[model samples]
Target: MSLRSYLVNLKQALSSRTFKTPYRIVTGNQSADMDSVVSAITFAYLTYSLKTPNEYIIPLIDIPREDFALRRDINKLLSYHNITEDLLYFVEDFDKFLDKSTSIDLSLVDHNGLQGVEINKGFDGGQVNVEAIIDHHADEGHFENANPRIIRTCGSNSTLVFHYFHDLAAGQEEFWESNKDVIELSLGPLLIDTSNMTQKVEDPDIKAFEFYKKVLASDTVNFTAQSNYNDFYKTLKTAKKDISGFSFADILRKDYKQFKFLHDDRVGFSSISKPLSWIANKFSIQDIKDDLSRTLKANQIELLVITASFTQKDTGIYTREFCYYYEGQNEKYAELYQLVWQQLELSTDLYRSEAISSLTNGVNDSGSHLKIYNQKKVTATRKQVVPIVKEVLEK
Candidate 1:
């Protein structure tokens, strides 16, 4: 069973009478990325091979199938594996194809992101049962009964999936012949996430990397192996960082997460792989703000925080920026802007860029009421910022 053909069958079966009960929807995070998507796919494939009678473990791409093309890096990997876009199923597929209502069993991967009837428009309001969890993020202690709930601080979730099924995969020649394309494609994220097994590299990730290398070295395997590891990592890294073709709106939703604050105020944060100065310079500050405001309104979000992170192309030094916008009248919004900035300033986790720490220097103070600051604490992430935002909204 070629992985491509296997996926084709799964997608077709969703529409047929065989669309049975207890759909084990193995899925990644909604804010999907390479590591998360591949981890879900890899786990689903592993489970499919080892499942009991009538157990269907379907790998559900967390993003819509329509928006799949936006992920250029994923597209590149698919092209590399000769897998077509139509072969895979998305969150929207369950609604489009299933004839009878059925309960869904979710197998979480990468992140503990639950996609139930409330959040998933394509669920048809089915009962959601979380069955399993395999991830790399810090555990939030939800889903206590989830079997095989393996959570650890690894460099990438893909590594965990590969290791979980490593023995079965290595021993079976038939498995390699059929599933090599997907299993091989899984390496892209693992390599890119760990910086070619050089930076932020962990023992499990390194072990998996070494294991795959030896597997490829086998004479029986008919897979196409990359000649240069550096080249392979560079290709995936470049694909992820290449935002040249994307508009400002596309960039926002590419790696975005939204939350509900006080009074049901919807807030969003987008993590871009490019620096703020580069984006603002190329797209223009006003144009970026205009596009962001329109997007925020369309999504019913009151405010959006854009966190730009990247290494300088010239200097080769990594940095981050905290850019924020609150949608509405400039006159009324300006009052809230000062207060929120006051909260951010008070927090030790964040600080103004060295250039303008003394004043409200980077603020536009115009219609958009936008502010961009070079984040002093580069290591501080959204995990550190979200609680502060919730506190700010309370006051």
Candidate 2:
């Protein structure tokens, strides 16, 4: 079946009374990046095509429907493939299923944790049985009992899902003919996540790419011939960094993660694609602090960290910045700040350049609610920084 037909069928199934128990919700991470969203959609489509008794496969993007606009890359890809919002379900839609008297099974993609409830408080009073997981991140062992738990340190979860379809399409020419769009759409995420197969490309990702190329070679749909990985990657990366319509809060929450830290305090780490100087120029330091405070209070968080990365428009050099914020009266927050400060100061490899701890030069002291750092010579990702913060919090 074509993607349009599959979407029509899916919409019908969602509204139909015949869509009985054993509903399978294929979901991705709370951040719902391009890779996560595509993996969930493709895997759920593949599962739906593979016949199962009374099982309705639904791809659930792990964010609100409105928030999808914050991810321009995702919107661009979906538009390119003619995917409409009506054909998709978001985290908020799960509540209706929870209220029903039906058994729900969850199939996680892109991430291997209980992200929907933990991050967004989406699934409430719902008894969900985890049936499977297909991911590429380091395992958190959240669903060890889930069957067919496929996890690897690959570039993208879409590549992992590609292997599933590739293996099934072997000697089955009809499978490729029926699901050509799925095969083509899946390639976008693989290329984007792997940086056009240049960065973080693992063995599995390469194998999947080769297998997909072979399938595309044999494909009569003529879709693969129209696009190349490099061009696609450029378009996607441009869109990924485009934060035109989003507010500061929307930009912060677009790719945010919350963690349980020392003494059960909630800590949030928000990753922004733009540089700190750009943000500072757009909004005043006081306004930024007020926004951070609002986010913390709304989420009931104790500490909030914002990490920004950008390229210098003049020299084309990449740089990073880290901003820390908390209510000044919190003792634990102060201790955590000091711990992070001390660690960054000692580590020459991570902080080879000077660390700037002031929002105002010589005007505000270390006890200020907001602290900004250059993080010079250190281009550590959240994957690297989160563990460091966790270690200090633990100590």
Candidate 3:
């Protein structure tokens, strides 16, 4: 089945007043990065094409419709591939059906845990069944009972789904030849996540690339692997970093993820592509703090962590910044701030200037926020920072 036909069928199902039983939702992380989006869509398409044992297979974008605009790169890529918004559904659309007592099955891609839907109101883990999970991140053991949980340290979840489809379609030459567009769409995320197979590319990723090459070669379409890789990677990377007209709140929520830790303590992390200095130039510090505070109250989280990365336009030098904030007089927030600050300060990869105070003055003394650091070395990513914060909170 081609993507267009599958989308038409999905639209018909959604338009109907009543849905069929045993409905399946394929989703990715809340961030909805390229890897997550492509993985969910491609995997869901493969499942539907293969006639998986499900009455309905819906691929959800895992974010609200408004948030989709924040992903500039993904929007460009989708447009380039002629994937329209009408063919896709977001979390806002899915939330309306949660009240109905339907047997909804979830297949999580790009993230293993239940964080995607766990935060939804009236969410009961026991009620909605988790069918499968394909991810490459650190597992938090949220879906221990989920079957067919394929988790590894591969570069992208798309690679895993590609191989799964390959194996399922094995010994079927016609099936492979017909899904050339699917193969092409799947390659976008693989290349972006692996940095054109230059970063974090493992054996599985290599094998998946080889499989795609061989399949595309056999097809009548002319697909050049090297040229496609270069074009896709550069375009996607530029789109990912293009945050030109985004508001402060949208910037924070662009790549944000929420976490619940240690008995009623809620935490949120926002990964901003631009540096703190750039944000400061655009918005006042108070405005930034107000936005952060609003996010905390709206989500009922105890603390909020903002990490920003910036690359100099001319020199290509990279730097990072970390900032944490909470309501005034929150002891738990204060303690967590100190713990995270000390851990980051001690890291060999990050350089802290001795001349600058460990804690920023105005923010800390304001009694609501703790500190912001330059992180001169700029080595640690959210993947590394999350674990350190988790360890401190667990202790």
Model 2 Cα lDDT, one tens digit per residue, 40-84: 888877766664523557888877888888888888888877888
Candidates 2 and 3 compared: the better one by lDDT is 3
**Candidate 2 regions off by >4 Å?**
51-54, 101-103, 118-126, 168-170, 218-227, 337-368, 376-379
Instruction: Give the per-residue lDDT of model 3 (tens digit) for 81-103.
Output: 57888888888766554545445
Task: Tell me the lDDT of model 1 at 144.
Answer: 83
Displacement of residue 233 (Cα, Å) in model 1 is 1.2
Every model: Cα RMSD to truth: 4.6, 3.6, 3.3
TM-score for every candidate vs. truth?
0.82, 0.86, 0.88
Model 2 steric clash pairs:
none
CA shift of 74, model 3, Å: 1.1
lDDT score of model 3?
A: 0.74
Clashing pairs in 3: none
List clash counts for every candidate, in order.
0, 0, 0
The RMSD (Cα, Å) of candidate 3 is 3.3
Residue 187, candidate 3: Cα error in Å is 1.3
- Candidate numbers sorted by TM-score from highest down: 3, 2, 1
Question: Candidate 1 regions off by >4 Å?
Answer: 97-99, 115-126, 167-178, 219-226, 261-265, 284-286, 329-367, 381-395
lDDT scores in order: 0.68, 0.72, 0.74
